[model samples]
Target chain A: MAIRKEKFTMIKVAAQNNIKADKIDEFIAIAKNLVAETRKYDAGCVRYELLQDVKNPQLLTMLEEWDDQEALNNHLLSQHFKDAMATFAGYLEKPGEINLYKTLA
Target chain B: MAIRKEKFTMIKVAAQNNIKADKIDEFIAIAKNLVAETRKYDAGCVRYELLQDVKNPQLLTMLEEWDDQEALNNHLLSQHFKDAMATFAGYLEKPGEINLYKTLA
Candidate 1:
């Protein structure tokens, strides 16, 4: 059967104290490229997009959808994801908030 | 004092278990218009925009910015806000999740 719907994942990161603007740029750039790779490689994943806070632009939100939870879990553990986390660790101002869920309706 | 920056508020709604597609459209339409009004009338609010889930398209997220917390509270209690809530009550599948924040760096 065809997939009915995908879940939306909301991820947020708060800037750490005294971080520089230039570093924020570097982090975001790396994130964009890395996330693109995950989307391309994960066939079960439906779509991924990033949104920036309108006023507090430093806050980044990612929207993702997958065929099902299993597909999502697998994608999370993929090599590209692990490598990206290792590389991007230093740029974060703080640990990120991540919430994943399937569509309710 | 000149306004420095605004806080970002993120809001989400889950679809009611048996909600239909057309009602989602109605709820979103009303929301989009009502939100536009709030942005135009509330000077302390810097910006507001809505984004939909990339995979689960029915889910929506609203991004808002305000001059400060007080401004945000005032906006929440505004006449338009109450009216919108009253008008849109029937469309909700569940209570919306609302999170407010300020920029760190």
Candidate 2:
């Protein structure tokens, strides 16, 4: 394995969403598309993946790792993200909880 | 980057904890040691990271990725894991919320 020489700080995001029981499938479909687009086109995206809780299928979390704050801010303002948010408005049980974190280890 | 040839299913775990405000630093100290030990000694441990919430300092999450169920189960049963849990008992505001997930994209 090869390691990159430059040092960079990563911005980790965990966006937790709880969907209505009946709208879980619809939520996943929209989420999967959003993940695909984010990973394909978003610059400085290291990891952008959707995860469904095994015990509670209605619970979803977008686990994201970006190179820095600039990358994360750009992603939030992107068209696909806005579109996904609009589509998700009706399916959410409540507003999503987004948390930003700095890795400690 | 060198991609491995073998195919394996990963078990993603998000273990969220809310520490007592005064115990946050102590909790992080214990957690950092656990993360280091898990990464250095545990087999099939792909990622063992401790993340502190940027907005809420008392909120911490352990983001883990294991190779499969057996690996996850093994980690849960390990002495280091058991020891960490015992040490964390008094520092926590409440029980940790553990969620297992599979990547969707």
Candidate 3:
């Protein structure tokens, strides 16, 4: 079998969200909606998933995979993202920690 | 088109590693070796990618996808993991932050 080489870089962003215990259910609902909307409307999105922590259910993570930086940039400016952020502001205990990463292999 | 539903739970673990500036190259080499070995040997590993931070080059993230918790547990006990951890001890500025996540959708 021949080795397949990936020419284009794929970007991954993991955002950690710590929500209040009381707002867990509400947060999940909103997040699910946001995921659905993003996957449906955002053409650049390869994978958009909302993950909940096993130890602390209140802790949530958003794992996103995009085609490139341009795609991710477009997502940042999209109306859906803006709307999601506006609604998420109240449920967050502190600012979410978002980090960007690129795959080496 | 019919929507495809994933029956089995796929577990994801994101580990944040902050390496000393001097050890970045060495760390990446070791991490690459580990990833290659894991992919070759481990049966349960679905995806294993080493990601670099765009803003902070010293910050590294390991995004892992496994079939289940049991598979993840086995990996934790694998020789490759132990060897990698032992080698990683000297390069890290701080303890790595490893968090487990479950996808909701």
Give each model's clash number: 2, 0, 0
Tell me which residue pairs clash in candidate 1: A16-A93, B16-B93
Better of 1 and 2 by TM-score: 2
Best by TM-score: 3
Tell me the fnat of candidate 3. Answer: 0.90
By DockQ rank, best first, the candidates go 2, 3, 1
Q: Per-residue lDDT tens digits of candidate 3, residues B40-96?
A: 998799999899999999898889999998889999999999999999999999887
Which residues of candidate 1, in runs, are more than 4 Å off?
A1-84, A87-105, B1-20
Could you give the interface RMSD of each candidate, to one decimal?
A: 8.5, 0.6, 0.8
| lDDT of candidate 2 over A1-105, digit per residue (tens) | 898787778989989899999999899999999999999999999999999888888889999999999999999999999999998999999787888999999
Candidate 1, residues B1-105: lDDT per residue as tens digits?
Answer: 899765454332211222234576776677777678987887687756555543444555565656666677777788887887787667655566554443322
lDDT of each: 0.58, 0.92, 0.91
Q: Which of the numbered candidates is closest to the native, going by highest lDDT?
A: 2
Model 1 docking grade: incorrect
Cα lDDT, model 2, residue A62: 98
